[model samples]
Target: MSEAARHELPDLAAMAAFGARLAERLKVGDVIALEGGLGAGKTTLARGIIAALGYTSEVPSPTFTIIETYDAPPVRLPIVHADFYRLNDPAEVEEIGLDDYREGAAMIAEWPDHAGGFSHEAACLSILLETAKTGRIAIARGGGDWLGRMP
Candidate 1:
């Protein structure tokens, strides 16, 4: 059965730490769907993961570009950071060649619902982020790989 893990990030540092931890467990073909409203730290979390994986320089948001690809060596694994917020139709995901991007690469997708959702995938991890008085709350849920190593 699938399970959920909740984390309270009191600050940006805490969120980055959490992201780093999650990055350690990532593998090829894994999908991390980030769901949150504006300014919810989805991009921040993605930056943390990319940085932790050995990526240097800036991590750009895919808001306009739709998808940003990062390869190995600079990063330990190939990864794609994508945003579907601008998609007018769910079918637009096909135009972006999402499956091609996922081949031997982990994916971090924001506004996944706009891309028809990734939760049905057995290896998908859904992270719901929300603002709170203290900082931010992150709830992760899904099956496949993360079922055993969740915090």
Candidate 2:
């Protein structure tokens, strides 16, 4: 495991702030793997990143559709938001054309383990979220490209 950093999010606002902070350093080809139990704010943080990138439209959860794509121009870069919770096997990822969707786009993947994990990817950032008595907490572990850039 790579060295990790912890951030305390007292509420949805704080999580949004963290996501905005993360957006400042984002680039194409980055993969964010979000891991946590139900209602852990994975989608919330992903929304923050998308909003911070200048997307004004509603950001819906990809739970059923599996993947959602946001084009560039309105945003600085293309982004792919995917929810892999429904997947029963890693092989299902290929059927969804994840690699094709990921080309030249940053990906925020929920339940990434179902998609075979992103830790091996050079620009992957894995975040584990947990509910706390007050709110929630996020622990981020970054791969080689994200080590020094983790917030």
**Each prediction's RMSD to truth:** 1.0, 0.9
lDDT of 2: 0.91
Q: Candidate 1 at 37: error in angstroms?
A: 0.9
Q: What lDDT does candidate 2 reach at residue 136?
A: 93
lDDT of 1 by residue, 1-151 (tens): 2767889999999998998987998989888899999999999999999999999899999999999999998999999999999999999888988888889999999999999999999888999999999899999997676777774
Write one digit per residue (lDDT tens) for candidate 2, span 93-145. Answer: 99988899999999999999888999999899999999998889999999889
TM-score of each: 0.96, 0.97
List the pairs of residues colliding in candidate 1.
Answer: none
